[model samples]
Target: MVCIRCKMVLKDELTKLGLHYTVVELGEVEVVENISVQQHDQLKAGLLKWGLELMDDKKSVLIQKIKNVIVELVHYSEEPLTINFSEFLSSKLNHDYTYLSNLFSEVQGITIEKFIITHKIERVKELLVYNELNLTQIAALLHYSSVAHLSTQFKKTTGLTPSHFKQLKEKRRSMLDDV
Candidate 1:
């Protein structure tokens, strides 16, 4: 589950199944008892209705952890990234940077760098819409070297400068919960 409401849906489904889960964190859930095959099947079916997958592999597990980390950092955190993103990801996932980068590129068909950039741009779009923070503030919050850097990167990614992106105020911001 990627959002609080998604967690709520999972919780409701678990309750309907009479299952007692101790924790329902992003990327995982902990149940108090072993579920029978029949119960598992039913629970899986219910979860499927909400478009949630029950992942059960080491690599997919790691991928989800990586996504969760990126999602949290970009969409949820308010502070600028403290260090280089590669180092931040390496420490968070407890894996070497090269391994994580290779695994992510192999599985997702895109480098983790691209994924982070897309998420950052999406966050910039949201911030731009709010209009509470100026261009300089957005650049600082997202850890761009300066407003010029953020503008240049934004233009490269979206084919429009930050001011142009902001001018299209009617455009919808990508939802973090979906990504």
Candidate 2:
């Protein structure tokens, strides 16, 4: 799960299946009772119907957790991170940065840094479309070193300058999940 609606769907499905859940945070859930095989199958089917999957493996779960952390940080959190991203991610997931980086690259076919850049650019596009924050403010909010850095990245990623992208009639932006 990556969004609130996904959590709601999971909660609804669990209730319908007569399961009690203690927690349903993004990418993780904790049920009160041990689920029977039938309940597990029903829950999996229900989630699948809504385009979600039940990840039973450790590696897949960890990957989802990493994604959830990035999504929450980029799209939801307003506070800036105190430490460097590698340190922060390593501490948050309680694994060495090298391990996480390797596993993420091996499984996702992209480096973690690339994943972060993609999401940051997506967020920048979102801010530009909103038209509330100027380029400098957007850069600051997204932790860019300067507006020039943000512009360079935005141009490199989208093949259009931020101002040009903003002025376009279509105002194209990708979904968070797609990013």
Candidate 3:
């Protein structure tokens, strides 16, 4: 549930159930009102039908929140981030960057920074597929130091230079929902 469609489903379900949500993110949703045990079970069952789960454990919930922050930063926001990914994530989640990194790596089997890079690269691929933004613009928008850096990292991650990736007709870009 890292994509817009997933968020929409969660939001729509909450509305249908007359439950107001403060947030609907990957692996978790925060409802505004307290619900009965039966209602909670019903909501969880309903979400399961969409292949979504209601996250419990505090650590898991925090992890999902962190992932949601990154996803929101990369895929949803129109404005560029003012800080680096580590600082931004730590600040947003109110946790030390080191602790967050350790927790994320331990649970997800990948570092938080690597997860961000993967999402950023996926965003770049989407922009490339659209052929709308030039490399320079894309690099700037994604906060890469330079187009060269973006190209270098992009090539390293996908095994193809951005230019080559742009020219290919097939779908090289991945779906964010798959994340």
Candidate 4:
């Protein structure tokens, strides 16, 4: 689960199944009691119907957590991050940066840095479409050193300059999950 709506769906499903949850945040859910296999299967099936998966594998769950963090940072954060991203992720996940990076790459077939870049670019697209902020503000908001650097990254990722993308009649933006 990467978004609030996903959490809501999970909460509704769990409630319908009569499972009390202590919390449902991002990629995790804390149920109040142990459930039977049938209940687990039922929950899984219900989640699947809503286009969500009940993750059981530890590695997959870790990957989801990583994705959730990125999504939250890119899409929801109000200010630019102050510290290094790897350090932040390492501290948040309680693992070494190198180990987390390696596991993320091994499971997701992409480096964590690459994933961050992708999501950041997607966020830039979203901001561009909204037309609420200009390139300079966007660059600063996203923690880029300068607008030129943001422009370079935007062009490299999308094959169009940010201004060009904004002027186009049809702008194609990826959903957060697709990213």
Candidate closest to the true structure, highest lDDT: 2
Q: What shift in Å separates residue 157 of candidate 3 from its native position after superposition?
A: 0.6
TM-score of each: 0.86, 0.92, 0.82, 0.92
Candidate 2 lDDT over 52-100, as tens digits, reads: 9999999999999999899899999889998998999999999999999
What value does the lDDT take at residue 110 in candidate 4?
96
Error of 1 at 171 (Å): 9.2
- Candidate ranking under lDDT, highest first, comes to 2, 4, 1, 3
Q: Is candidate 1 or candidate 2 better by TM-score?
A: 2
Q: Which residue pairs clash within candidate 2?
A: none
TM-score, model 1 to reference: 0.86
lDDT of 3 by residue, 89-171 (tens): 88888999999999999999998878989999999999988888999999988888899999999998999999888767344
Reference-based lDDT, residue 152, model 2 = 96
lDDT of 1 by residue, 86-123 (tens): 89989987999999999999999999989989998999
Sort by TM-score, best first. 2, 4, 1, 3
Best of the two (1, 2) by lDDT: 2
